[model samples]
Target: MTAALCLFLAAINIATLLAFWWDKDAARAARRRIPERNLLALALFGGTPAAFAARQMFRHKTRKQPFSTYLMVIAAAQAGGALGLALA
Candidate 1:
């Protein structure tokens, strides 16, 4: 909840959102797309909320197997971690 942590999260989330937008654009243009692992890494590093937002906003990667599953898992883990911190 500190200012620095909020700033970092905001920056990462914005980057994640932009990455998704770029990937969707690339997909439409048949260009080289962003890697799934990189996208997941962004989510893992505090971009989960923005990842979900981008997925819904761009309608991209919604049905991808393993990727959707992984994103959900990451979100769940993040929620649990946050809950743990709150309880602690």
Candidate 2:
């Protein structure tokens, strides 16, 4: 069950990344309109890594803003979670 969950999360992350990579401007526009709370919810549900990677790869949402800052924080948390899982 844990493995399945991890796989599902990873797939979602990958799909999110691909979506951003393919259309960063569209994604950014959607992201801008979407509520920060919802984005955070998505990250909390295991989408942070892809979100962060997309931000970096597309150079999107790097400006100094509360939303960007929150995304970074979530990215760090995701990294920690991944590290912990790996170590375990």
Q: What C-alpha lDDT do the candidate models reach, one value each?
A: 0.99, 0.72
Error in Å for residue 12 of model 2: 2.4
Our tally of clashes for model 1 stands at 0
- Report the lDDT tens digits of candidate 2 across residue range 1-88: 4899989898888866765565556665665444457555667677777877877888866673997888778878878887998899
User: What is the TM-score of candidate 1?
Assistant: 0.98
Clashing pairs in 1: none
lDDT of 2 at 52: 77
Worst-scoring 10-residue span by lDDT in model 1? 1-10
Candidate 2 residue-wise lDDT at 17: 70
Best by lDDT: 1
Instruction: Pull out the clashing pairs in model 2.
Output: none
